[model samples]
Target: MSTVTTATNATTTHRSARSVARRTAWLAGALFWSAFAVLEAVNHGWLAGTLALTFFVLPDLTFLVALDDAPRMAKGQLPPCAVPYYNALHRALVPLALLVAYTVQPFFAWAPLFAALCGWMAHISYDRAFGYGLRTKEGFQRG
Candidate 1:
């Protein structure tokens, strides 16, 4: 299900309930990712195991932040945030994919891996489906 609610601020006004809904949707996406960490801990090992999972996530953070400027610098907001979103999903899905390739002992290690990939894919698809993408034109007009 989806919703469309509008809010106006003294400093700014958002157009369409879609903007707020988009933001709310992204928040939920992040929350879902964080929640995956918790579930991963239980399935993969526990608190310590999840901490070990951090080893996988940390490099991803570095790469994502490091590349944050590259796309903007190159595209000048041309390709827009589709680059970051795609990269973020790749950053997330890659390790999870590796986990799938390397996991042993229990079969469920792949579950969180699968969930993370699904979440990433779903968010990207949602954004694309809803026409929610970074602005590409100069002085991008307000919604």
Candidate 2:
């Protein structure tokens, strides 16, 4: 094979490996965090459990913000108006940051906040493991 062909093959191989690693990492995260959230609920109270469950389903509710536009869009695409909300909610950093904040300040009641963050992280992790991720400005999954 030509040098260019060899380079292309190497790049593709690298990307494929990275993709597998990424998916595996997220899957592990989903399992751990989801379990952590459940444990927190069992240990703490209904408040902890309820908040965790609520936040897990909350991110996807952004779709309701642009329901009318959803029909015209391609499958797996968020409407442009809802893209910002979807992207923000889907990002792991947001919940991670909140968890850090809770650690630093201890301002909120601990158990519920912790459980909610864990659940949110679990949701994001599951989405990533399944190949969903933050949307592009055009509302399509980023390449």
Candidate 3:
């Protein structure tokens, strides 16, 4: 093969490896956080379980905020107005920060909010594992 072809192949291989690593890491995070949420529910009470389930499904509901704009968006694009809410919920740091705060100083009786954070993190992790991520300001998935 020519040098250019070899270089292209190498770059592609490197990117493929990085993608696989990223997906694998996110998958692991999903599994761990999901399991932790489940355990919290079992150990705590119905409120913990309910909050966990709620937060798990809450992030995607941001789409409803701009449902009327969907018709004008490009394929696979979120509505621009909903992008901020979607990006905010999909950010792992948000839940991670809350989790750290809970650990440092418990609140909401600890278990329910903790479980919710775990579920939220699990949702984000699963999205990342499946190659979904925060959108750009224009609502397209960031490359």
Candidate 4:
């Protein structure tokens, strides 16, 4: 009976921890996108600004679709072992990709791509500012 109680407590604690992780991740993501959209809308047209914001969130949305536990992780339900995937999507690869694209086609300015990159940077900045960091196999922790 004592062992059973101990196991139950441990499980509850683990679930709580995962929940915190997911909520924080979602908060950070939301903050980034919101701030980015507002900033872009001030400088660009509303439609373009929102479209850029969508592009910024596209990678994360893709992960949510591809990973079984991604939504759960975002909701703080279960610990996710998706650190690598998260890192890949959150990194500066989008900007770099845009740079490469521009280099390949010097005539095309690719303003929209640049806007998306800005949105991506905004998201990463928000995550760092909010202490969401990244997830690990065990759980989310500050990096």
Candidate 1: 10-residue stretch with minimal lDDT: 1-10
Q: Per-residue lDDT for 84-138 in model 3, tens only?
A: 9999999999999888888887454578899999999999999999999999999
Each model's C-alpha lDDT? 0.47, 0.93, 0.95, 0.62
C-alpha lDDT of residue 97 in model 4: 72
Predicted candidate 1 versus true structure: per-residue lDDT over 66-112, tens digit per residue = 35555445433323334454344444355456546645536545554
Off by over 4 Å in 4: 1-47, 59-63, 66-82, 93-108, 137-139
Evaluated with TM-score, which candidate comes out highest? 3
By summed lDDT, the worst window of 10 consecutive residues in model 3 runs over 101-110
Estimate candidate 3's alpha-carbon lDDT, on a 0 to 1 scale. Answer: 0.95
lDDT of 4 by residue, 85-106 (tens): 6766666555557646766886
- In order of TM-score, best first, we have 3, 2, 4, 1
lDDT per residue for candidate 2 within 67-101, as digits (tens), equals: 99988999878899999999889999889989888
Which scores greater on TM-score, model 1 or model 4? Answer: 4
Better of 2 and 4 by TM-score: 2
| Clashing residue pairs, backbone N/CA/C < 3 A, model 1 | none
Candidate 3 positional error at 128, Å: 0.5
Candidate 1, residue 90: lDDT: 40
Model 4: per-residue Cα lDDT at residue 42: 68
lDDT of 2: 0.93
Task: Indicate the residue-level lDDT of 16 in model 2.
Answer: 98
TM-score of model 3 (CA atoms): 0.95
